[model samples]
Target: MTKTTFTGQRHPAASTEAENSVNKVPTETTMNQGGDSSHLSFQLTSHKLNGKNYLEWAQSVRLAIDGRGKLGHLTGETKKPEPGDPKMNAWRSENSMVIAWLLNSMEAAIGKPYLFLPTARDVWEAVRETYSDVENASQIFELKIKLWKVRQGERGVTIYYNEMVSLWQELDQCYNDEWECPKDSVKAMKKEENERVYLFLAGLNQEFDELRSRILGKNPLPTLRETFSEIRREETRRNVMLKLDSNLEGKNIDSSALVTAKNENDKKKKPWCDLCKKYWHTRETCWKIHGKPPNWKKKGADNRGSQAFQSSSEESGLQPSLEVPPFTKEQLELLHKLLQSQLQTSKLDPSTPTCSFSQTGQGLGEDDWQC
Candidate 1:
């Protein structure tokens, strides 16, 4: 809008007093300074966009970046875990913008823990680009809230989430809660986990008589979850080993927890040896059968004080020949979280009452046991 003013002195005309008439240009609104409304109109035509469009739309998000200059995520975003330097857990507590975005990303995608590591980086970038503009776009600052409904088509284990999201939800809830899943399903997963573990241990055995016949023909393919589980177990085993070593140097390394050893002549049979052809020995004591000299020390073998025991005529001291694997910090954290959540949920379960027969049967003799 323009300001209008009438000058006091008017031009004098000869016949009649003629007043000057002029029109002031209508003022332009601030919206015309930088052309944006036009492009915004075009942007609304598309409902679903790709990663590129998503990034462009980020410039319109509302930002509350702190003194550190990090921006908050869109309101409708589901949170994801912050996959950062493992040592930065404590650091993130003071950085709410990072944590909040991570959480939103996780929630939005229902992402698996393994998937979050890579997605976390993109999430932060998305939040930053979404909030570049401070005004005129606040109404659409938040990400779109597109939703979908799950419907059934056919029954099978091979269907994708788009077809079976609801079924998985029922199973996934057990991640934290101990609800009763169908016995068949629980039994099946447990059986699968155990069978996978057994096959893995069997594969580790160096002296399987028919490794090719049993394994190569079977064509077993390890799953992402199974591989992850084994990786975690081995890692925890390594951690326990390291902790034991740090606390027990100069002490005997106990193999009981790791592997059991016993003589065949003992009351019960012990786990057999791969190298030895005897009943009373393990792979550790198999030198007697392998015909190796008692003092024999294999080259490149772990010699963790095994030399302290002098070899007989040809018995090498037992040592760990297998390479130990290390665990990632995230795996350790996941295990700890799983255990803690399980423990908390277990304590919340109602106890089953037990009744004794002796406490019942008023009409019966005191000597009778009847409920």
Candidate 2:
């Protein structure tokens, strides 16, 4: 009865079970520690919360934390374990990591007070109470004003669509209401979607007028996404057409400029007449050969003719001719008598040289003229 034995080693099954328990603890701890360490420098979003953007910042943080499977820490769904519990260390470690992430995602002044908070949920609630203004009518009015004014002016369709969607999402969050009946909810959702479609169409640039009309003409109006796709396609097509039109216009302008320059050069190269001192004609076709017209003075032809005559006389070393008055009948008879008397005197005195006129009746013959 006194032969009870106590051994340092346990049964094989017991030892294996104990070893498994020890391995499981370390494995779970390592996994949690690894997860926590990986996200040590993680920022939820590029936009830091500064009280004014609390709604948007909250949405971003929720999305990021949910992605990491740690949203429960912020929502209080993941409860704190008892002090001596095996999971207590991992829970505390993960909670602390989440708190760090939240702090990092906030503005320094806005996040400092939350640094000493006990848990992530406490920090989340504190921030919410301080900045969440979902029920504020002023906020709703401001959001409505922004939505009303959003337009596609100068921005690409995708950019405009993104901005509008962001505003819609924020506005929706502000007016989140749960319906009692599924049918009513569906109907309400459809109505809201239709209203959004109208808003989107209205905010488009006038360039999309035809497409917008086509979309509105449909019996059962297209969904917002479908309308957006159609509009996006149209935008791409318009861009291509505009580029082609600009290219064609540029080519036409270049061709017209070239033609104009060529015409100017051709005019510059035309023959000039010395007799008329005018462009586009030679001495053969000058007005002097054709005889001066009646409207020469009215048409400035007399001035041109005078300039040409003056230039030609200068070149030929001759004096310009002056206009002579018409002789009256008596004056002509007197001139003829004087000429006959002078001729008779010249004949009586053969020593005087006589002058002869040329066939043109305008100048003396070269042989009859003295130097």
Candidate 3:
């Protein structure tokens, strides 16, 4: 009267429902242990395959898959197990996970057709066959033209060098030739490297003209890497020099502007005299009100006029006249008083006859008074 469980052994007349439930249990368990849903949903690369970027996209996919230790799934190194093998369910789960990663890393349009591929290898091979252009002569030719025309125009040395190196690597993939002899291969590589060095030098901006000439003048040309490093160092030096020159120029402009402003302010601050209608002296110091002093004529004459007078006197053999001091204020007052007293005396004495002052300060006649 004991009941039998299907887990122990499969009966010869096992029902379809019992077989399906048994198969589902192990498949679900294997999927849970071998491939998490998160792992299947993860995007392999930031760049999606869009037919044109097949080489770059393939490289990314390979790196991502290899990192996950499931590269053998795509490479066919992990062969499929026969039915009923203990590892068959785990292998299936992992393969399905790899397929999901591939689809997730492709463009929607490019990935849709490959969605139902039977295996990871099938999907990878199919995509590669459709997009790989390794043998396209026209593409190689276009790349060569672009490499020759690439210039450092307004770009940093690092960025320009990176761009050139990427192009060179792509070209290398297209022309991967194998030499039978090791020595011949090394010689060919040297020749190719020399050409690359020339191309790199030729593509630099005019500012590196002198450095490029020096690099080219060497009997044994430097390697491409050595040439790049040398040029990069030169670029760094030039940038520093330019920055210093700019700073010096700015300082010079600031100093000159300050000097000009100070001069203008000094001119504006000078005293103005209303009486003399001149600058640098006020009405209190006007020469007209103070009367002329000793050497006044010489002081009034400019340097050029004085020099001309001196030269003329030397030529004529005449000594320059000595400067005479003007009359003092006390003497001027005394002279005025004497003139007034003399006029009064003349009025008082009719016999003396009225003495008249001369307007020109000279005696009009022998009886006239002169001052």
Candidate 4:
């Protein structure tokens, strides 16, 4: 050895290489090298293996995987290689990623069993084997019975239709494709469609009878979705009409109450006088206008004469005379006694000659003045 080449520090080239390695950006493969890395920005659809909803759960999970572009991994289409194969590590890495996705998509309570499965395909197969069609006939029969009993009770057309749709989807999931021939499949599909239409029509509330008939009467019958939309619009129209009617009724009630209150107030505030044809005072208090005095007939001669005099005066624009009431018999007797006393005093005192009594034929008689 030509003297061992030793230095206090590493070569510049080695140092540069180390620096470059430290500064390198992670590639997609390296970022996902850990088999269970998740890159999704959202949570996946969750499924539960609660024994009764296996079909629905499986369908939902399958849809979830397909939506995320990882259906191939779950279906065994993108298969993982066996151990010791050249691409075994890569295969296992991808398979592990798929298995992690599936595990995340399961509900916590029922997901414990499938958590340790090696591959997504294995997990799917295990779940399917356990809950696929254990009681195919009975399950299908029960689903059919439920579909048959489905009704619109209390729910609006839209809600009822959505419920029916869920039942139909569940019924469809129960079908097995292995034993279905093209003829039987087509026939079954048509029959199911017919049943669906019938169920939808039958379940509708009576308010939608005419619409239901119209939908059924179409040349090529409308799909369940189209029918549902039509019924929703009808419901909206009914609601609007009901609101209008309610508003009208409220207005009417308010108007009637106001009228009644106004009438009552008018009655209380101003009583009517029928005799005067006026509203200020009642007939009882309007005696001056409507009633005659009880002694009017006894005082009629003076009253008539006074009325005639007033009429003449009013016609000629002269001053009116004062009116007087007729006197009673006792007053006349007192007047006669006073006049007799005056005569006796005149007799005693001769200074004043005795005045003679004279009757004026033109004037009113004394009897006329007496009551």
Candidate with best lDDT? 2
- State which candidate, 1 or 3, has the greater TM-score: 3
Instruction: Write model 3 residue lDDT over 179-265, tens digit each, in one string.
Output: 667677667777878888888888899999999999999979998878988999999999999999999999999999999999999
| C-alpha RMSD (angstroms) for model 1 | 41.6
- Give the backbone clash total of model 4: 0
Find the 10 residues in a row with the least total lDDT in model 2.
1-10
Pitting candidate 2 against candidate 4, the one with the higher lDDT is 2
Leading candidate by TM-score: 3
User: Please, what is the whole-model Cα lDDT of each candidate in the order they appear?
Assistant: 0.35, 0.73, 0.72, 0.64
What lDDT would candidate 1 get against the real structure? Answer: 0.35
Model 3: how far is 367 from its true place, Å? Answer: 40
Q: List the candidate numbers ranked by lDDT, top first.
A: 2, 3, 4, 1
lDDT of 2 by residue, 1-371 (tens): 12111111122343343344223312233546645444445556655899788765776677667767899998889999998999998899889888988998899999999989999999999998888875678887988999999998999988787777767666665653666676777677777788889999999999899999999999899988889899999999999999999999999999999999999999779998888688988887687898666655542233443445555677778875554324444665576577667778888999976653212132222332232
Model 2 RMSD to the real structure? Answer: 20.1
Better of 1 and 2 by TM-score: 2
RMSD of each: 41.6, 20.1, 18.0, 21.6
Mark the regions of model 3 whose C-alpha exceeds 4 Å error after superposition. 1-39, 75-93, 112-119, 218-220, 273-278, 282-371
Q: What's the lDDT of the predicted structure labeled candidate 3?
A: 0.72
On residues 158-221, what C-alpha lDDT tens digit does candidate 1 reach at each position?
A: 2222222222222222232232445655555555444433443332323333432443344454
The candidate with the higher TM-score, 3 or 4, is 3
Best-first order by TM-score = 3, 2, 4, 1
Estimate the lDDT of model 4: 0.64
